[model samples]
Target: MKITYRFLLFFFSCAAFFHPIKNAVAQENWPIKPITMIIPFPPGGVADTVGRPVADALSRSLGQPVIVENRAGAGGGIGMAAVAKAKPDGYTILLALSSISIIPEADKILGKPPSYSLSQLKPIARFTADPTVLVVRSDSPWQNYYQFIDAMRKSPGKYNFGSSGNYGTMHVPMEMLKASQKFFMVHIPYTGAGPAIVGLLGGQVDAVATGPSSIVQYIKAGRVRALAHWGEGRLASLPDVPSFKEMGVPIQFAQWAGLFVPAGTSDFITNKLREASKVASNDEKVRLIINTAGSPIQYLDAPEFKAYWDADAKQMEEAVKKIGKVE
Candidate 1:
């Protein structure tokens, strides 16, 4: 009996050791094949800007060629929906933006509902966040947010403001501002933030509400003048620009980026991706890229990210209510 028990114990010990080793190997080789990172917006937008570097870093870390596929259309719904329907094999992920949370609300205003709910995807990590800025031509007459708001208040719907898309971060905040300030401004939605900046630069629009990533270059070139940032505080990149509150405007908003995999992906693979993202976000190269772009690399691990996202969504809903139903 004693000999039989000793043999059984040895067998169990070997199985426990080998099982973990085998699992680790399998997890490490997750993307043995090329992986796809989906950017829901067109190239040259914030999502693309942040995603490219991450893809490069992830490729090196995973030993696989990671590619960024631009699937821009339908206000980011088309690409996001693709992610929801993707196989949960840890090979595909969505570079989700703050706009992802508002798709359902925006759709409700349009009399249509989003095909896939936010719950269908698993949040991996919150990669970066950028404050929205209100910019105009450097040579234009408006000097500050108050002056701009005074003009808009007098003219109401006569002013024109350009944004990336209908439900984009830039659009939503501007709409809320108009409603709160009791003004009417015609909103022009471009395919992406790049085109919106181009429109502003070409004198096609009176002003633009965009992230610093797209407009910082022009600010540095003395081509565009920043009126105010829609953040609690000023952006480090444009220290001269004031916040909305400081400008006496009670509205604030920002754009955030995160990573997500399909809901059914294995927990181990998702954890691995999360760990890699954390490392990439903290890398010196990534920091330089974000700072040079005028946006900071803000990292929020799983739990913190969920809380932040939830509060943002709730605030958006309240803003939508106060701004009235928009289409």
Candidate 2:
């Protein structure tokens, strides 16, 4: 009986010791299977333009396929909410935009329950920063930023500006412009950047506020002419077009794309993802693809991304307060 008791105790002790070791090994071997990158916008949008390339790079680095899944709806809330509630195992990740920081505050302004809190996400890295540009049809009467502003001021509500959706990244920036400039134009909100740009091309809207990637092709094709970019300086691709600051608008905003995992994800997994993202961000092919999309490849690691995200969140919160609700 004594020998049997000793044997049982030893067995339990060994099992207890090995259990945590097994878990550690499992975590160390993270991403043994495929990973899914959730892009909260339709294909051909900024997220898709950046996410797909990053996903490809990650796949090569991790030795596993990283699939990009588009879950476009609710101005990016639906897809973001899904990632927020997903298991914190680093398998399911988010390729998020500036709207992720804006939508939560917009929801509060609209008196809706929060879809996802900033705390629910852990920023892995930031890959791109593309400034927003306001563009008009090439055939429009307004030839430059001054002309467009003058026309809008003279005829309030005569021109209409289209965006991705209500209270989205594109919408909020336009709202800020209106508030600052005291110009009035009908706000036209579309489902995503693709449709919003389509609206502009189809003559459904007077102008569109979007990232360079979404409309660079149209701008090059002479289908649309950029009036102003919301950046501190001119874009290399559109050097002649002045920035909002140059025009005395005092607006500088860019739609940044980054990788995120659910909150509470293990540090080990997060570090692994961060390392993989660093590799992907520096990949020559990935950089080429992102540059071709018209968004500069600006990489920030996890710690830096977290700080940037916090600052961006605060800025968006204040902007939302000034713009009030979309309705």
Candidate 3:
């Protein structure tokens, strides 16, 4: 009997000791299969512009494919909730925009159930962060930034703007400007930034506020003219353009793309992703693609990304409050 007891104790000790090693080994072998990167918004948006390149680079770095899946809905809530509820195994990840912070705040303001709280996910890295630009068709009657504003002020609701969706990053900025300037522009919500741009071009909407990357091609093509951006200074790619504040709009906002995993993701996998991401984001090919598209890489590590996210979220919360409940 004493021999039996000793043997059982030895067995339990061995099991305990092996468990951590087992986990470590598993983590090391993580992503043996493809990883799903949920972009929360659809293709052709700024997120897509950066995400596809990052996924390609990350795949090569990790020796595993990073598949991008667009799960856009509810102003980006559908995909976000899926990521929040995803297992913390690193296979399912999110590369979302600053709207990641706004959707939940909008839910709270609208008195709806929160889609996903900021606490539900962990930031891995920030790939690109660019202040949104306000663009209108080149053939429009308004020739400059002030002309557009004066027209809107003179004929409230006569003009309309397209957005990705309600309470989306695009929507929030335009609404904030409306609140600040005391003017009205009918909001036409679309499925994604790509569609919003189409709407703008097709005359479905008069203008749009979008990430620099989303509209750079149109601006260069002479289909749309950039009025101004929501930045402190001009973008290097758009050196001739001016910021909204420079035009006396008194507003600022940026759209950012960042990688995130469900909270409780093991640090081993998170760190691995971070390392791979650092390389992927800095990849020369990826840089060329995005930079030529208009936005330069604005990379931020996890800690710094979190600080940036926190500040943006706080501002979003207040912006939602200011916009009040929208039916």
Q: Select the stronger candidate by TM-score from 1 and 2.
A: 2
Candidate 1 residue runs with Cα over 4 Å from true position: 1-28, 322-327
User: For residues 145-188, could you state the per-residue lDDT of candidate 2 as single tens digits?
Assistant: 88999999999998898888888878988998998899999998
Task: Indicate the worst ten consecutive residues by lDDT in candidate 2.
Answer: 287-296
Instruction: Please give the TM-score that candidate 2 achieves against the real structure.
Output: 0.94
Task: Give the candidate order by descending TM-score.
Answer: 3, 2, 1
RMSD of each: 6.0, 2.4, 2.3
Clashing pairs in 1: 156-184
**CA lDDT of every candidate:** 0.83, 0.90, 0.91
Give one digit per residue, the lDDT tens place, for model 3 in 75-168: 7889999999999999999999998988888898889899788999999999988999889999999888888889999998899999999989
- Sorted by lDDT (best first), the order is 3, 2, 1
Candidate 3 regions with alpha-carbon error over 4 angstroms: 1-20
Write the residue-wise lDDT of candidate 1 on 1-327 in tens digits.
Answer: 357988999999999999989867877678779889999888877887788888888887777888999898766888888999899988899997888887767777677776577788888889888778889999888998888988998987787998778777778888877776788889888877777888899998999887887788899999999998888886789999998788677878878989989989988888888888888888888778877888888999877888898899888767655655555
Candidate closer to the true structure by lDDT (higher is better), 1 or 2: 2
